[model samples]
Target: MKIQEKDGTIVDVFAIYWLENETLFLGLPKNYGGLISYKEKNVHVIDSTLNGEFNYFSTHINGIYHWALIKEALLDDIIERDEVAYNRFVEILKAEGRIDPDFY
Candidate 1:
């Protein structure tokens, strides 16, 4: 269930705090809080200070989660690691009649 981040480090899919099925902000995980490492030279080195620096997503204007979606890179990792959840998401998209089969 490990996937590489945009920064090139691998992380477990479940290690992220995804807010699935919640009435608000459903499916987005807490984003990094200024602790993201850019251009990591050593992939083997794990940062001990990463845990307490996560920040939950928010918006200046409140709105329903009709557009709560993960980035395509994360989606690719989830699809590779978790079939059940990926299938459920596809089903939901199908139900909405908005899924582009080719894109998914």
Candidate 2:
């Protein structure tokens, strides 16, 4: 998914770390390395969606953490776009058992 900055710059999202305690943490690439090299940099409440489809999220960028309401579709797209990463994350969740199998 692409996050647009106030100046119109777009940032591409890489992966999702997990959804914990009703919050979502997303992972983004940190260097020239691949997806495995990503690190968590953004967070938002899972149920913060408005109309059940939109919500604001926060991310730390350039020493500042900014918030913006983004389309939930974008988040779903990100997960769908990287099935391998998403599955790996789900496995981790299953191992931790933080969520019920039916929910994942």
- The TM-score of candidate 2 is 0.27
By summed lDDT, the worst window of 10 consecutive residues in model 2 runs over 61-70
Q: Give one digit per residue, the lDDT tens place, for model 2 in 75-99.
A: 3333344555445444443455533
Off by over 4 Å in 2: 1-80
lDDT per residue for candidate 1 within 43-96, as digits (tens), equals 332432222122333454232222212322233334344655455545555565
TM-score of each: 0.25, 0.27
Best by TM-score: 2
